[model samples]
Target: RTVYVNGAYLPETEATISIFDRGFLMADAVYEVTSVLDGKLIDFEGHAVRLQRSLDELEMAAPCTQEELLEIHRKLVELNDIDEGLVYLQVTRGSDGDRDFVFPSADTKPSLVLFTQNKPGLADNPAAKKGAKIISIEDIRWGRRDIKTVQLLYPSMGKMMAKKAGCDDAWMVEDGYVTEGTSNNAYFVKDGVIVTRPLSNDILHGITRKAVLRMAAEAQLKIEERLFTIEEAQAADEAFTTSASAFVMPVVEIDGVALGDGTPGPIASRLREIYLDESR
Candidate 1:
């Protein structure tokens, strides 16, 4: 497989970054994942804009321009023969030959890397049909959830916790409210209305969430943006999640409680269909 590191494209095994890089040492980096369908990037512009926003919020320098980033994404997708899959991009403050708690000098350049995953049946993932079962976990990570940083240890652990509980994923709760899934934005449907937590530092502003909500509004589906507890979601008629990789995934059960006959709800199914149809 081909991967991009710094300015060079090379085999994945050949790609390298300094061990002292801040992204590795301090988790000081921003990243984005853009899905690919039919060899075309899905919402590339949206991901690029969000990437820039994350960099700006963290006061990190962009490794390259948006146009350059797009080119690299396309190039890697092409090189990797990605049809339906994902492109992962990361930019980090480069190593300054020494590790320190203080920020590196302004003259230090940033490192850029990108790669693609080939998922032939990404849009038709069978899990979407069966719907996902999720367990709830506490949100104990740092407060800057808004920034798309690589500090994902807690989320990784949360996913593991869910797996150990025989669940597909985990929803993070903070102060009795659902912030989001371990890696996606969370939502539920009640009496035909879609309820998802509003955008704030409490949750990562999902690119797919914005698109799904817009399409939902356009389709005249009832919508509401507010905090909903796990109990509320479990009581909901149906529930789902949105992310660049997963798109829209239905949630059938929460913490051992089934929602609506333990089946994927019609609204969630329809939204997933709409999302796939429109996105493709």
Candidate 2:
């Protein structure tokens, strides 16, 4: 495999970043991932926009133009011969002699890297067919959850907790309201109405979530962007999570309790079909 590091493409075995890079030392970096299907990048523009937003929020320098980034990504896909996979990109505050609370000198350039790899088809998992289970965890992340930063220890721990509980995913809850899954946007359907948390610093505004909303509107389904509690989710007729990779997948159970009939609901399936069609 080859990795795009700074201005050159290098073999993965040879690719390297400075040990003092803030992304590695202080986790001071932002990243984005976009899925590619049949050799074409899906929702590339949306991912680019979000990447820019994350950089701006962190007051970091833009390493390259969006067009340049797109070109790099295309070349990466070709170099890696990636067909059904994801493109990963990251920008970090450049290495410094030592860690400090203040930002690095303005003359220092941010490190930029990009790579691509295949993700197993979780959407087609037989467990997903029946719908998957999830467990709730406290949202113990920094307030800037909207930025796609590399500080993912909290979510990582949450996933471990979910696994120990025999759940497929973990939902982050704050003050009695469910925010989102560790790596996906959470949504639920109640009385035929689709509900999800509004875009805010409390959660990442997912591209797939936006696509699902658009699909729901086109399907003439009632959609609401509001906070729903764990109790409310457990009482929902259907539940699901969305991401660039997962697209749309139902949550059949939460906290070991079944939702509705413990089956993938029709609305979730229809939205998934619409999402996959439009994403192509």
Candidate 3:
């Protein structure tokens, strides 16, 4: 596999960063993941725009222009022979050759890294058919989850928690309401109305969420942007989530309670179909 580090494309083993890199030392970085389908990038522009926003929120400068980023993504996809999968990109405050509490000067360049993960038939994941069972965990993450930074220790722990609970993934709850899935945005449907948390500093502004919701609305599915508690979601007729990787996936159960006969509901399934149909 080939990977990009700094400005050079090299073999995976050849790509390297300094141990003093701020992203590794202090988690001072932002990243984006764009899914690939049919040898093309899906929603690359949206990810790039969000990447810039995340960098801006942290007062960090972009490592390269959006056009350059796109070319890099294409090059890596081609070089890695990625027909179906995703691209991951990271930008971090570069090493200053010394560790200090203070940030380096603007002259210090930010480190940029890009790689491709090749997964065939990702859009046809069989798990989406059976739907998914998820457990709820406390949202212990920092306040600015809206920023797409690389501080993901808590989310990683949530995945482990889900694994231990015999579930596919975990939804994070704050103040009795679901914030999001550990790595994706959360949503549920009630009486044909789609309900999800509104965008704010509390939750990520999911790129797939934006696209799916728009498509749902255009499909004449009723939509609502408001907080819903775990109890409410458990009672919802249908539930699901959206992400660059997962697209739209059904949530059949929450906290040991099965939703609507524990089968993937029509709305969730339809949205997934619509998402896949349009995205590709």
TM-score of each: 0.99, 0.97, 0.99
Error of 3 at 155 (Å): 0.5
Clashes of 1: 0
lDDT values, one for every candidate: 0.93, 0.89, 0.94
Instruction: Give per-residue lDDT, candidate 3, residue 50.
Output: 97
Scanning candidate 1 in windows of ten residues, the lowest lDDT window is 94-103
Clashing pairs in 1: none
**Better structure of 1 and 2 per lDDT:** 1
Expressed as tens digits, the lDDT of each residue in 1-280 for candidate 2 is 9899999999998999988899999999999989987788999999999999999998899999999999999999999988788899999988666788799988789999999987555335466587879999999898988899999999999999988887778999999999999999999999999999999899998988887898899899999999889889999999999998778888999887788999998898888878877877
**Runs of candidate 2 exceeding 4 Å displacement:** 120-127
C-alpha RMSD values across all candidates: 0.6, 1.3, 0.7
- Candidate 3: the clashing residue pairs are none
Ranked candidates, highest lDDT first: 3, 1, 2
In candidate 1, what are the lDDT values of residues 157-249, reduced to their tens digit? Answer: 999999999999999999999999999999999998999999999889899999999999999999999988999999999999999999999
| Residues forming the 10-long window of minimal summed lDDT in candidate 2 | 119-128
